[model samples]
Target: MAHPYVLLSAAVSLDGFLDDTGPERLLLSGPGDFDRVDEVRAGCDAILVGAGTLRTDNPRLLVNSAERRANRVAAGLPEYPLKVTVSASGNLDPDARFWHTGGAKTVYTTDRGAERLRGRLPGEVAVVALGPEVEWRAVLAHLGDVEGVRRLMVEGGGQVHTQLLRQGLADELQLAVAPLFVGEAEAPRMFGPGAYPPGRMRLLETRPVGDVVLMRYVPVAPGTGRLASAADRRWLAEACELAALCPPSRTAFSVGAVIVAADGTELARAYSREGGDPVVHAEEAALAKLDPADPRLAAATVYSSLEPCARRASRPAPCARLILEAGVRRVVTAWREPDTFVTAADGSGVLASEGVEVVVLPEYEERAKAPNAHLSPPPGRS
Candidate 1:
């Protein structure tokens, strides 16, 4: 998977407005802070802005830092990330300076506006429309698939940021708090609205650049950052809940669980459904997709959110056995099987022979148990 980072770079006053409702004007992020914003611009693979911002600031949206540009070139990256804008009503300006910026431009519009806006704006830039309206998921897929943008940086003009945040799409947030204040209630707020899930973001550093104090943050694993004061066990529990949401497969979403590690980077994800062979379980499903021979899974923790059964009637061995044999050290789980077909009890003993530490986060059990209610057996059958 490409590095999915949505960097929210905005200059908001103490009152949280990007700009007032007067004629489109640059509210904050003065010339000195523009240079500061360049660092953020250089780090992302794509730059996103709403059409309002395109019409208002007409930002060049390129990394002008001489040192940063040279480093990006040495790293074999294009001089600039792709520039993207979203407009639903097709009220975009063609002569806007955003067209002549460093990066190639793409406008995400609606199916209704595709032909009309294409004819009106009429430029070399590509125009893509998802459906009747703008679908961010389709847009995200386009960014990752067509544009090859792994890291996406979203500079908001309120509505777009609100949409992204409300849907829990944005991953990182970078705010440059200007010394000035725009107290008008009608001004655009930095973040519009959203129910943010539990995730850890660390302040890489904070420095005063020009009149604004620039703050940079990157998402860490949830619970590792000071910002993550509360643990959203519901989101964490959704690991198995999400697995249950997928169409049922032959192998019951287990026999193929996995944790991918190539270098220190890890990708712990589940397979939705299986086709070619008997479907594997979530743990083995993801693990099977990668080469266990790859060094990545060596030291990674596989949190299956369910106890790996020691024995299964349909499958050869159990996932626990497979995981241990893979040389994985840490296993975090939710439930313990009570049925006779699977009787590993703690199951950690099987892993202990291989010197693995098992952590049972029962908080996730309720989520994993929700779907298996039918197979759970009558309460007092014993």
Candidate 2:
């Protein structure tokens, strides 16, 4: 049930309109911002749009930079990410640019709609029927398992964005705000009315790109994305709580770790001093319970109360090395490992250097540090 990391990318006017109501297509993004978006598209494994967008925009959705395409090829990827569309009615024009210009094309529709689209679309295109309705969850599962898509980019047409956000399926939102106003009520907006996920989205970063400003936000209650999902965050919190259950150690920092599958299932959970092994790291203990040949490990994520140890004397391999060896691709932690045990210890840097997706949620730092308050260094060195 693992799904690709979902990123919602959109450009909006100052007034939050996707475009003006004029007959011509409105250009909300500047030249520089357009290049930025192209770079984003190049990084994703697939790009998805709604049927409305396909009909209205008729976009080619290609990576325009030849250099970028070459880089993708060198990296053992296709020149362009796969193009995907979802429709309830399956009513689409075979001559649309979206059908002919992308590397590979896929259409997800209702079971009844699939029969109608199969004869209309080219033989090269894939038509998938997901139950009686177009379910986003099923579409994502197919993309991850069948299409081998890890990173998914969602280009908007209002309803699509709204549906993803409303379902808490989107991981990240990249909003490029142009310095103009589109006051027409008939114009499309970035999102339609829906009961969006509660709590404010966590703002990750903001930067100015030419005349437009780019703002990135991660979902607070994440189902999937580059950042940790709500479930991941909750698991990390539980890891911190587990730290309190560990036998207090004077020489080592008490920590907890949980290994989670890509589909948000907990694979294993462990804490320091687990099974009376004082030297065993939390991450190492958790991973020890899993089989070495488990294929799910490749897509699993490790959630730790504290950063995995980079250097340790109690064990031959550190937690960071163990995680990499286990093929866990992502790591989420509450706090960075302080230098109380080893000076200049940087577990995060080690994981990142090895190409692991490491994310640090500073909001839970205090909670993670609570159990180790006794290990704090004296106010001044003796």
Clashes of each: 13, 1
lDDT of 1 at 196: 49
Residue by residue across 208-236, what tens digits does model 1's lDDT show?
A: 88878888764333222112111222223
Residue 148 accuracy (lDDT) in model 2? 94
Clashes of 1: 13
lDDT of 1 at 172: 60
Model 2, 361: alpha-carbon shift in Å? 19
lDDT tens per residue, model 2, 1-382: 4568899999999999998878778998889999999999999999999999988888999999999999999999999999999998989999999887859999999988898787798889999999898878788889988999989999988899998877867878999999999999999999988677654666889999999999998764423345445456567788999898889989998899988775556789999999998788889999999998899899887889999999998788999999999998888898998778799999999999989888887767889999898888788953
Which whole-number lDDT from 0 to 100 does residue 40 have in model 2? 98
Looking at model 1, which ten-residue stretch has the lowest summed lDDT? 223-232
lDDT of 2 at 174: 98
- Report lDDT per candidate: 0.66, 0.87
